[model samples]
Target chain A: TQLLEQSPQFLSIQEGENLTVYCNSSSVFSSLQWYRQEPGEGPVLLVTVVTGGEVKKLKRLTFQFGDARKDSSLHITAAQPGDTGLYLCALGGNEKLTFGTGTRLTIIP
Target chain B: DVKVTQSSRYLVKRTGEKVFLECVQDMDHENMFWYRQDPGLGLRLIYFSYDVKMKEKGDIPEGYSVSREKKERFSLILESASTNQTSMYLCASWGQNNYGYTFGSGTRLTVV
Candidate 1:
């Protein structure tokens, strides 16, 4: 089974602070995706990175796939209260997705 | 936007009772998946169906069963609810393009 581990299971920061969460794996993945989940709701896709060393930006969030395709990271710039949610990373191939443990982020005012 | 709907948002059942969780997708996706989310275990796939009446067991399928009678609807069944089975159950569907899986709001089940 493919397993993805995420660091800093819980994070708390003041608004305007920058934070980065890392997702690491021993096995390589064909593609990786980032998702944000609000309380009592399913996760929403944030971005997907398919190529090694590829980086994609969505507004204040930036996602990068590692050069070995075995890791990824999500960086949030100037975090806001709205960014307080659970962040999940998923790796996909062959039509199945393996999700990470997830990071719970809280941005304080 | 793709829409996935689950029958119940919250459910409470007693131990040894049979429970059913239903999921439906409006996008006519070919693949539907059932997952359970725990505090530190993340989302673990319980079962998945690639087509009508065809099913595959995922990582954690020991205490669960799934039924897919039609293309758009999939159901997860617990033969006998247990306290260990209490968790947030999620449903997701994916189209042929493999763009991404769209998830439903999820059902929080409590077995007491």
Candidate 2:
């Protein structure tokens, strides 16, 4: 229902570059999850943030939730080829019901 | 490691044929879900089962049905396959230990 909107539908950058993707919504969210899906595989949940203004880090990846809880951002530093995948943001409504328009990132070697 | 397994990696079937996609999870999770993914439109939930014989409709449940006879296995049945139904289907289960849904490799189905 267009609840979540992700920026940069497609992004390609050189290896070792830094990048950030955004997921925004006008409706407030109770909790949000970030997932990475490689080609030919189901998406894997990277992290979940429940509190407003919360931040979580996984290796070179950094995730932040907005203070209003209506948006989130994912930043990657010194990205590698292995960082290439589609990043999706999902809202935990009734039961993790909705997904954002994904950002497909490609880190070129 | 705990796993969610889908029966077929790929399938090609004639239009109007009945199709069955099977999924099983070994984690003994209490919840299981089915989702179909497409190119631009992300993953859309088709159905989910919370417990044995307890099923719930998701965002896009039209033209689809699910059966969970046991705690481990869940099935998605297409009463009559159509070209529109050709998409990558995925199965997932939620576990308290895992803290998130673990997905199957996915089944890419084609209708001719």
Instruction: Give TM-scores for every candidate, taking all chains together and pairing residue i with residue i.
Output: 0.98, 0.96
> Model 1: C-alpha RMSD to truth?
0.9
Residue-wise C-alpha lDDT for candidate 2, range A16-94, written one tens digit per residue: 9999999998799888889999998888989988999999999999999999999999999999999999999988643
Looking at chain B only, the TM-scores across the models are 0.98, 0.98
Candidate 2: residue A3 Cα off by (Å) = 0.6
Model 1: CA > 4 A from native: none
Mind giving the per-residue lDDT tens digits that candidate 2 earns over B1-112? 8899999999999999999999999999989999999988888999998899999998989889999999999999999999999999999998656556788999999999
| Candidate 2, superposed: residue stretches over 4 Å from native | none
Give DockQ for candidates 1 onward, in order. Answer: 0.75, 0.63
lDDT of 1 by residue, B1-112 (tens): 6699999999999999999999999998999999999999999999999999999999999989999999999999999999999999999999987567899999999999
